[model samples]
Target: MNQTDQLVDLKNLSPDALVDFLEGMGKEKFRADQILRWIYLRGVTDFSEMTDLAKSFREEISQRAIISFFTPETIEISSDGTRKFLFRLCDKRSVETVLIPMEGGRNTLCISTQVGCAMQCSFCLTGTFGLERNLTASEIVNQVCAVRKDYSVDNIVLMGMGEPLHNLENVVSALKILYASKGFDYGPRRVTLSTSGLVPEMLELGQRIKVNLAISLNATTDEVRDELMPVNRRYPLSELMQACRQFPLAPSQRITFEYILIRGVNDSQADAKRLVKLLHGIKAKVNLIPFNEHAGSAFQTPDENAIRAFQTYLLDRQIVAIRRAGKGLDISAACGQLKEKLENKLLGSGKESSLQGK
Candidate 1:
């Protein structure tokens, strides 16, 4: 086989899979652990830099296994320290990853699971592109690999361009690598997978892995939800709520229900009360996101008073509801706003003003 044909991307393998692959190469499983630390912890791509590995073994492994990373074609930095990275895939399709600075010194890396979305959530701009393709396990994991090159990612959210549960297999494998002690070493608390109410896959994901689960629950009733999220039609509020209740969450970990508050749509006192009623016994918190208006989307951001009133109503009922600020608002990287920008390329050195039509 040619050299390129023999090479396998080490980043794509889970800890167990990597060990098995190394064993196939006549190396001990412990070698996989050492290589994982070198790749993830040290961010060293060159096999020669793994000083502990014997020189001859390094040459053999380097010939058979490869570390693959694709740098972002463009990066847009926000004033609030949010960095949006646009990475062009090998197929020429691209997806965006956002690094959001949290209140503390840590940063949250928001990565995509699919090239586009099939959910067709009315408010989400990504769905406008339709489901181009599901990302590979390597593609999903490499998004983190690309970002960690410059920033320390304390938290990772599979809440970017597509519905994570749609690409269940690849997404699960990527999560396994993320939580591997020798890989990224992220615990359940540090990683979250947000789904657009895919009932079966949500439960399957809970069973397969222990990452935090967040549901993109926009409306309280099925009628309103059907108009906003098409997936609600398949798994209505009743089925979805039942699935959430059945979800395996740690005693300390609560499922996050992401409710995007849209003006004159599903942002009312009655809606808030119904939300409280819906989440009655379920261990969940409401992440209230005021709809981030983008081009082609008719929805408007709710008034601050309206947003606060919604939160206050939930708070009064003893539910934990927090309003999430649109961190990358200025750079079109906030919630439900990665629209036509997907077709355009931001030129120059990652400046917001450098936006040019593709």
Candidate 2:
């Protein structure tokens, strides 16, 4: 057998899987815990650094197993202190992860589950790239671990580049690692999975994982939503809202409906009224994201007055809604601005080009 095949990546295994693998290797069950502690709790990558293990045992295990971690090809820091990391995968595919620092020392990390996206939301930058591939559980989990090396991330959002529900299995498997006490150890509430209203997967996610859910609900009616997010056409607003209603929620928890307000599209007093009516009986909070404009996006950011008026309309009706401030815009690290910079580098033209036509 190839030695590389014999070498298991401990980072890819869950605690139970690690136990089984170690047992099969004729090593003590406790070895699994020791190795995991060194990798996760201690943040040690090399076997030589795991001093608690006997030198001979470490050498033997080193030859039979390996710990894998993805290092970023480029780390870009925005003027606003946001950091975007472009990680080059083993297969040479690239993905971006971002770290956003907030008030009171709280920080949130945005992670990507897919290389590109299939949702094809008309206004999203990543949608323009189309679907490249879904990330593996290790690929997903490593994002959190890697960012933790720099900033003590207090929360995580699956809102980086792709529709997380589109890669449900791997996303959920990665969540298992993030929720594991012996792994990333992030509380379920602190991790939010944002989807473009994938009803079936949303229901499954609520059942399988206890993390918070955020829906990218850019429109109030099927006609408008179909234009903004194509996924809405398949799962329509009614069915998506029904899934939200059926989703089990812990006490004091409310689903976050993210509405990206675009000028001349889905940002008018009439639209806001329809949205209030549509969310009738759902336990929800609203995040009004004034569309993050990119070089080639047809959408324009709504004026502050228009955004505030829409927010005021929601607030008057007892809806908890807030206009989310755009971050990392200088470095193209905002919601819909993530793709162009990487795409420019990939093309090797060194000129800032939009993927809109491509």
Candidate 3:
């Protein structure tokens, strides 16, 4: 069998699988737990660091199963204390992850699930990059492990480059690994998955994992949403709201609706009023994100006065809304601004650029 099939993502495997694999290699079953602690908790990269394990056992493990980790190719620190990391994956494709430091001892890590996005949101830079492939469960988990190893982050948001629901299985598997007591052990409440209203997946995720949910509800009407986010064409606003009603949220948990304010698009006071009506009786929080302009995007960020007026409209109706401000513009690492830089070496060497359109 190939390595991809025979070698499981050590993060995805249950304790039983680890014990079985270790026993097959002539090591005691208890050694599995010891090695797991070393990898997950201590964040040890070298087998030599696992001194408690027998040297022969460590050598055998090195020869059999591979322990994966991500090395950041580029790191950018925003003026607002936010950090973005460009990590090179096993397939040589690159993805970006961001770390945001919030007030009150809260830190959020925004992770990407795909190299590029298939959901072509009109204003998103990532959508312009086009689709590549869904990352393996290991690739997703390695992102968290890598960020945690390097920095102390308190929360996780699946809101970087690609749509999390599109890569549902792998994303959930990665979440399980992160939630496992033997692994990262992050509380489900601290992790939030953002989707562009994939209704079927939303229903399934609501039933399966009780993690926090954030919906990218940038537009109040179907006409506007379909123009901004193409996914709205498949699953319209009505159906999405119905799914939200069925979503199982904890007593104190309120669904977060992400609204990106675009000039001359969906930033009008009427849009804000319509949004308030659409979310009536549903426990929700609105995150007003001023559009971050990119090279090819025709949209511009909403004026400061317009953004404040919209925030005031929502608050007047007792709807909670907060503006999201963070770092990333300088290095193209902000929300919807992560794209891997392609080198000119291939072009100079008479090779077609694999990352040309993507």
Best by TM-score: 1
Q: List TM-score per model, in order.
A: 0.93, 0.92, 0.89
Pairs with backbone N, CA or C atoms under 3 Å apart (clashes), candidate 3: none
lDDT (Cα, tens digit) per residue for candidate 1, span 55-152: 99999988888888879887878899999888878766778899999997999999999987999988877877688799988899999999998889
Q: Which portions of model 1 miss their true places by more than 4 Å?
A: 1-6, 335-339, 346-358
Q: Tens digit of lDDT per residue, candidate 3, span 39-108?
A: 8899886777899988887776776776778888667787877888877776666788898888886789
Which pairs in model 2 have colliding backbones? none
290 in model 2: Cα distance from truth in Å? 0.6
- On residues 1-358, what C-alpha lDDT tens digit does candidate 2 reach at each position? 6677777888777777788988987889888778877887777889999999999988988888888887877788888889999887876667889999888889999999998899998987778778888988788888888888878999999999888998988888788777777666788999999999989889888888888999999999899999988988799999999999999999889999999899989999999999999889888999998887777877899998899999999999999998777788788776536555766776686543334245
Q: Which pairs clash in the backbone of model 1? A: none
Q: How much RMSD separates candidate 3 from the native structure?
A: 2.9
Q: Where is the poorest 10-residue window by lDDT in model 2?
A: 349-358
Error of 2 at 73 (Å): 1.5
lDDT (CA) for every model shown? 0.87, 0.85, 0.82
